[model samples]
Target: MHEKDHSEALKARIKSPKRASRRMSMLLGAVALGALTTGAMLQSSFDVGPTPAYAQNLSAQVPAATSAGFADVVDHVKPAVVSVRVKVAVEGASAEGFDLRQFGLPEGSPFEKFFRRFGDEGQRPAPRRYGEAQGSGFFISADGYVVTNNHVVEKAREVEIQTDDGKTYSARIVGTDPKTDLALLKVDAEGGFPYVSFARNAPRVGEWVLAVGNPFGLGGTVTAGIVSARGRDIGAGPYDDFLQIDAAVNRGNSGGPTFNAAGEVVGVNTAIASPSGGNVGIAFAIPAETVQKVVAEIKEHGAVRRGYLGVQIQPISKDIAEGLGLDDAKGAIVARVEGGSPAEKAGIKTGDAILAVDGHEVKNARELARDIAGFAPGKSVDVTVWRDGKKREISVTLTKMPGEKTASAETGEEQGGKLGLSLAPASSVDGADKEGVVVVGVEPGSPAEERGLRSGDVIVSVGGKKVETPQDVREAVKELRKEGRKAVLMQVESANGARFVALPIA
Candidate 1:
């Protein structure tokens, strides 16, 4: 789904309840077998006591089979559920501020004089509106540590949590990991609190689960459903592995816990996919494994530290795999290696497809990113890559990711005939790299323009090799053409940034 659509769906789930319900009912069957007690009747006629054999026989009948219900599970887990209320300072016009626009008066109108007497003509300070938002959370420890979504308490001026027992306590933010949307909070309580632990084993996809949260400000709401799917990537973040459940999760359910039949938290209620702003039997939660790791890190370090490998990677598509002579469209293709990054230091090159990290198979770019981020900085790991139609492993020592950075574009150029582009040495253009050729002009309706090449774009590399001059670009293109390649990949650097463009060689 589109990012906007997912965000809209998540927001909608917070305000509306699920419209569908699945009622589970159970029936019990009882059968009674009686034997004529002639001895007991004769004893009653004689006024004798009841026989011990008859009473023992009556007690030995088969017991009825009992069906499982959620009442016991709810009773056990609901006490730890909490309602999180946040007070945010919203910026807007205050009620005291008077505007002539409200009276439908144009600028410089005669009525401005009458309004000016009531309020100042100059811009008044925007009113600070105190906005309150509600969500759900649960206690993770007895000492008053609670876990919730980061978005629930983010940017809050004041936070308070209400337990199921109707007692409210002021909550302080302990730590938060925005990447996974998880936060740790602490409440000052007198004694040990009821808490739940994360499930050690992952619940099966079809297993029944319970969700308890404050949906739409409804405190202590309970809903039941099954785990619909696993490892769902809803485009939330780099670590997008979420569990999809059919629970009736709605607004105010953020940061709630999804428990398995054992009453262990299997996931944290996060988002839903609903078009009408309500649960449509599809809700997503952060898996227990991810939550456990993030929460523990937050508790220890107050932040999440992710390992970084400096390279821009893209998923290997079937066509890309075919172009690279690969058997399967698996792995992440390195588009560009950041200068001085660990990947560059370890001799990782552009156009190399990463297949595994430390022997763990990486299926695609997202998987690779998640796996790499899970490691600690300064840890060395073996990375397997496919280059030149062969597999090789390289050991790389990870480093802490520096703040946000973007790869600069690099491109190469050659005598443009079929592509129809005018090229010149990049050194000829100001602020352009000296090792590539710059596009002086692109012919209208040509393959160069169609491939997004434009004037002032520098070509840094052709066919994954650096090119300094037009002759170098021509040589690379000639090599690819001799190899019968249909398209040549060029690394292009423009004002926006660096990106790889595949232009048709024909």
Candidate 2:
């Protein structure tokens, strides 16, 4: 027989339902026939066994050990997760007629009569539109204290939490901190509630994690993944240090707990990155440290009191550092110190670079801001600053940031030269402080203009030294050139604010 005929015969035999009991036998017979045909064509021969050797040795093959499953972890943490539902009042006109067009029911259709018994579609005043939203939360105390996202319960007229076992309870907002997007809620239960504790330490990247929450209104949903990244700043707030995970966290997962391998709450799932409004593997969680801190303050005082340093600061750019004769670009450059603020009282001057706080090194402007805000008002701290090519430590006693709106001056003079600018003493200009030289005019295409120096700007300091008279500015520039410096750092105070400008020394 031809090889094609043999192949066709084997295919037909395998497809025959009558060979159901002999399915394996038919498969083996087909393989043997194919092999025999090839052997005949190639003029070679081989033995055909009743069964394959690999199949016979299946019992001897051992599978690799599998990692522990997540069932136990889910069981331990699922009870603590709760689904939060909120009802918000909506404002609009109420339609009072049965509008057939709204329900897609043809005008005067027979089906409309059947549905009319259910409700007068047009006569029903748009049932006082109540906006309904759902999210997730977890119990933090046995007495019924719960933790959820600030946005979840924000402006909610009625907040309710449903437990894993389907028991629902009305929850009241105890406090909320919008800066960190955290909120605390309370529920009343008779016996007690299953609560979870925040993890003492943060989870490492690549470590296994489980996110348990009510995703898409599905109660007690659990997803598993590893910590993808940490300390992610997505610009959600001023103190944004979120933990990024690859778990399938979707809508309604907000304010839920992300547990570690030990079933400890490592973070609170808050937001997700999805272009299609579904889980695409990227989600963000507020670290447990921040949650703990914010929660404690809320529980104690019913609000979060943040420490603030009254100073306008900016990051030290490469050009600013080079102009200031620094080897590395680090620390925050003090742009303007509030007149009566803690920084001003502590002798923290304009143009000073804040390098450290309480002996802890500050990396940049954001770090400095975060560190300062971590402390409480009326607390004293040691602030180290880099000034005049040297470091100096100053003591500052923080004060509560003012809640009221705060309010600055102007100048003139003309003196043009290699710097391509005009300067005059502030005393010569009206409404100007008599402490620096006033810039009356700037050459259209001069280096001063290129550096953002404009007319009416006051040059408060040059090369780390304060300037009083127009001659003081000229002398500073001459001294910088004599020292072989390529550029001079000028602290200019304008109506907008005070900032450092690096001007080239021609």
Candidate 3:
């Protein structure tokens, strides 16, 4: 691949401006999109297809009178973009029981009268306030509906929206979906207003895109880039299907929209990867397809309702794949099935390798979880699993995830001298004194002692689920042995912090 001129419309959108008054949001968008497009073209240049055409036409028509360039797209979308400001009230320390006036207050009077003279009663100094944060958002509907990131409005007591024209409107939260970091707000505008429409299809790889948002409270900033990658999982949540771009999304750009060349909203700028809190070119956006679904759901219902498949799952590692006689590790491996839950009803069990759901391939447990949760409860779906070296299909009705429940603690008598290490329940400590199996006694030459298993460490989870007692540890070990897995990943919380330790169960 040849180096394209940075100003060849494709690269010009990403170059930094001469002054420091630069908009990080737009810059990061361009960088991310450029990276995405370059990677896609490298893999399959001829596969650019019609997607870029849809994107290019929108970008190419720069207004000639304005020295036609990327800013033209910015001008077209700026009116609909707005800055959201939030204020929060913080509570101060309470003097609940103490009474300074007790030494001299009137006998029958409550402390009110004495405290009033100090002006702390009737004029209770306004609660200490904190957040006065600003972020970017755009109108999604002509009827004054807007979309932004949930983090942009989180904990905000009052939200106000300010357009590029300096007019501000008081906005109310319509709904929010934290799983996707998206929120919807409304303003009471009298008539139709400028708004951006969502693209009917997902933005194709290598397509030009633009981002508009407020960065550092600077209003109505715009940047352009191309789609660098898709279906990126940065571990933000189980449902991470982020569109990676070279567009510069920085702080304050969290809630802005990314548009295709046709001026249609294609992505919602959410995050960027930069150590200095400025755009370094890598950014991520929530795809417009997911945004449309989430926004519509929030508008209809006050909250999101996701389906649940009750089972503990993990990605199939290479060792496990070879042990199971598989070609490669490319699916989710079921570790445990909830009794009487959907997995059990569908004849799914521990050690089953899940290949796909309803014909859509699942690359890992997180992908499977996200796909399943996209559906509503009681919906029937077909699951493909690899068991005993063959594929099988099972139909199951999804259920809701049960509320969090505490597991019983595992207690055991100190067993020492067997494993070269001392082991005991981690009790009587400041943090884990309440309920942790401790490692008390270690023999100098045992494997446990060699592995550095200490006395004060509290085992919190075995194989990713909380284990309350030592008996739970035994059960997990037994199950792992039965499944033929060699190691059990244990999450141990110590006074210092939490760390994962993979203990050999076989």
Candidate 4:
């Protein structure tokens, strides 16, 4: 996706695959605002994913540079970096849309005038129009296979790569995975090409790192910084494990490489957090661990397939922990179990707190998600969940993730008293769940609204007890509060599907 402005605090984000990494855009007047835009260095006008462990060479590249400098490392890996340019049909925009900001080109880019000559994006020209997207990439093999962000070549009519020697060559897309925001492109005319390897070890936070790629069309730009942090989720995608750095990552710098002291590619620059849509010393990169795994799949299968453990999940908050009769707020609570899913087949149910997977302790929701995705389809694994105050283990066979998951899930009836909800028996409503109470209304600025409850939502149960009417719903809340529960967990079924929403009792 292209760069977009944030009107408020990182509240909403607009992005599509194209050229360059994205940034957070919040239009803050006197205060601070935050927004996130993506499509990192070099074009599908810039859009950019989680990855598995990539096998890489562990041999030292001139040893780790000392505090003195990174001159040796930079000299070794710069040749592998290249500027990626994708020419798409003038009107060949993605279903979402595209614009100059999406392209992330510099002010003096040669094609800017031509794009404006035709007409505004709203007004299409009679003749075919040709627009180009640019970002960055580096060769992964001597035979000329390059790795870049998927947004760089999305909907591309043709691809052209510019090497360090100022030579341009045609390339073809091998495979692109939007989930990981990574793509593999092969150069047609193959000779021995300058290539780099993914880092064998993850870089430590505060360790020295270098970023190399095209920024604002300036090729071979090099900047140095330290790994600011690790395991950052920028809400870029479902699998959003990014490396945070302090390097100067700009619009045209997306898809570039971030290297550790060993001259190995540790990450691919993908996004930044800035209010003005420029560098603010804060940037994001897809870790080499994910990159190597994703690149390998694309090279071999021409597509990426991830494992799926179907369940609607949310974090176990402190209040929820008290309600669930647990001492600590850890692991992920199953809000809803997908019908006919591997989870459902394994006897997993709503309100089950997933504590471990295959004996590995589950820390939270994100950890569970990543661990599940790392597995291959058809693999049977042990899943342990805390149910009815005890941990039970079940085996589940994972399936291939579907394009779109249909929700078959729970919500509860409402009582306007303390919970600020109005309710009716489901039998009283024409099109409602057969066994629950319907939510007729939610009080304004009420706890129900804060938890996403709305009219027409069916409340199936409260505190694990089924409720069939307004009185039943009221009794459930009253009983839970009397038991010293801080919140009430309600199984709600709405238009989207059924899930659990916990509302505070105080």
Candidate 5:
């Protein structure tokens, strides 16, 4: 029924939902006038109608936002949003190039080669390829500074933005942070630009939000929804603390602004969790808290300078907590302390559980990483860690994170009895440990394998003590169990990096 029918029905549902009997004044949510490019609407008008008395009663009971309305909010913020267009260079080619085929337009079509002749003034640049992409962004200052996604301008050679009023202006990339997928752009005209500010607080779950963007290159479209959740980690990066919203964000909505009822930008629309590229009501946005910080740094330095404490870490599991005598499975267990890093200088060793930083409780590895990164480099803070059944505070002065790397591990397999781990001295194994027992193998379905120990993982320490041989590991484990501990913690170094694993001594 699609193509024509699909366009007709979508128009109907959006433009003319059923009315109530109580004579409610209708507010047209949004209009995409003359916006249909790929298709046109044949059935342009709908038959007017009224609903039963029950429909009126139900409508009355609904929230009064119908009366308060989003039109005011939309009017306040829509002008700040612009449709950003960029001539993106081909993957490897210079920014002054384009590959039309790679632009994700009409795939498998002959237009690929025909579009290459996009030369104006009888001058075709070199044989390099170029493509164009469009997304949404908003001005954040009266000086014409715009905030958008890093992906919108990454590898962009020429950038221009068309405002809601159809006026286009050339823009320059001010700065970009790919880790947060946020980019700042500057329009260099002398006139003051209409702009919006970031919301001081994140929107609460179920709070109303309006997403304004240029979907499918359609100008200044608006959709309404509520905040679905917060602190969502979509694995986009180590700093991923996205706000989940059930909004109709689409492809061109990337880098657009999601505003609160007060017309303040609450989030920057980023990734959509949909199987097909279209929106399925599950979209993630970068919270404005992150945006304000990142944009501020970008404005000041033209790059984000994040505090670094170079320690590879993993979340504390229940078994690991029990092994370390922790009351709860919280905090991040330091796996490997990078040489010369703040963690190393602070005497933070492998197997230390980082419980808090500057009195802020770190609930997990991601939080700890994010918290540390939030600080400026050269900032000194107190990091609390649990070691040897006690908590101690260590002062660390952070340095600029050279390059961000978050620890992620995938398990593999065979091995022994007892703890289901076959162990040998590091000296006996090729390319093995200088100060620990090497895992020769892991038994399938055993505790060792379940806890993610692999054949090549060098067990560096048992029960907080460094072990050079398999016999030393056994002795340490036996001693820890003799103290009535149900689990033993071992520092194991794998190819990914060093991490702590808890194996049941029982």
Candidate 6:
């Protein structure tokens, strides 16, 4: 995949570049609004869990910044960034026909609460259209080319762009990529439009950065902070190499840009670490290095074609690291190699730990996936791996993404100590039950394993929340932690019947 095309890929997923920035913004906004409504729940959950180690006995308050110099950066970048408003034609069947009554009763249930919260479902007929959703975006080119997250523009019938100066332009989507959540849009505007350029160099950690975006329909808001961290993954997607900044990014700032000291756009301010909609001093940015490449590719091509390596890989854990006889738990460990894949053709085998790709270090599976996906199909690259206590390198040609099949394993190997137990998708055995977590293998002394978890026991719920997939388990844990719950009450299913168990968690 071309570098410029990747951001475009990000754009394409979000909507078009013009609407994507706003789309990505809306996703975060929804999370915030949800959090705000459930703030009390989150606070209660926190009190129930073990206190954060970092906060133990830490009572001193940090002093506020004495200087207001950073405000200048926000003022400089605010003009180029804008709020995007979109009017989407929501089909009546898609929005109204969907049943909300099904979600109300269960803890992990999706819909019942929706009907109850909104009111008597039968009495209130659903609206024919969802009306309009507002978001944010920024200008990238002087010729009126704009970049945003794909989501903001997705499903929108009409889009409008508004700058800090109150100038508005009716926008049109160019293309969108759902995978990366980025989008591109163009407006019929005259030339000589003010635009921001992305910085070429990597912004230093702790370096001052400025965030500008519209927060909750509020226009032209600016906040400042330092780069908190880099390459932070928030479990949002596969390619989550976010630049974590300390800047205060709120709901409306979704598609806005995060700028470096030179006034160049360094990151697309996307998400923040907050239990509430307000900032908690941790925000994420789509790095400029990744953005520039995606933008350029979207400009040239309508879509992004990413390279694929047909293998299911996971992070090397201490157990696997010991089992594999490696020096340390680093790089991506191939759990299963797909048949007839580039890995198979290149002789890459299961248990082969990938160290690097094209000389770039492969820290983990996601990094390897992102790096491999960074290339177009048919591109060949060198891969270094550790097999049988020896380092070996293999050259493999990249393939198309959707063409590769994801392999399933029988062990709960890669999820680490996050979820209670390792599980695989349930497969029907004619007379066997389906639709629950099938415990293939559990770690000895683990919470689940210690609780008499067996190879075939199916988990139906966690802390009264249903467990459907690994994602569900993760969300349950997160919700448990948020609610200050000490133990996760799970309903387990087996060949005989269903029973409940509480798994204690720290």
Q: Which candidate leads the pack in TM-score?
A: 4
Error (Å) of candidate 2 at residue 397 is 1.1
Q: Go through the candidates in order and give the clash count of each.
A: 10, 7, 43, 62, 9, 47
Mind giving the per-residue lDDT tens digits that candidate 5 earns over 1-506? 86986664443211100010001121232221111011101111111133323222111122334576887667667888999998854544312223343556453356543443332323333364577888889987767788888877765768899999999999988767877888999899876677777776778999989898987777789999999999976555556688888878877888899988777888999777654456678778898878887787777666676777878787888999999999999988887887777778989998898899899998877777777777777789899999999999999998755422111111211112368665667665557645677776554446785666767778888889988766677678768767988888988776656667788765
Model 3 vs. true fold: TM: 0.61
Per-candidate TM equals 0.62, 0.60, 0.61, 0.64, 0.62, 0.60
Query: Model 5 lDDT vs. the true structure?
Result: 0.70
RMSD of each: 24.9, 29.0, 19.1, 19.5, 23.4, 20.4
Candidates' lDDT values, in order? Answer: 0.72, 0.70, 0.64, 0.71, 0.70, 0.63
324-365: candidate 3 lDDT, tens digit per residue: 888888877888876777888889988998889899997766
Judged by lDDT, which candidate is best? Answer: 1
Q: Candidate 1 lDDT, tens digit per residue, 243-290?
A: 989989988888999988777899999887666666788888998888
On the 0 to 100 scale, the lDDT of residue 175 in model 4 is: 71
Angstrom error at residue 167, model 6: 1.8
- List the candidates ranked by lDDT, beginning with the highest: 1, 4, 5, 2, 3, 6
Across 367-467, the per-residue lDDT of candidate 2 in tens digits comes to: 77777767766779899999998999999987654431010011112322367565777765667787888886554346775555777888899999998
Q: Give the poorly placed runs of model 1, Cα more than 4 Å off.
A: 1-68, 93-127, 404-506
Model 6 has an lDDT value of 0.63
Error of 4 at 136 (Å): 0.4
* Deviation (Å) of 57 in candidate 6: 49
User: Which parts of model 3 have CA positions greater than 4 angstroms off?
Assistant: 1-67, 91-130, 404-506
Candidate 3 vs candidate 5, TM-score winner: 5
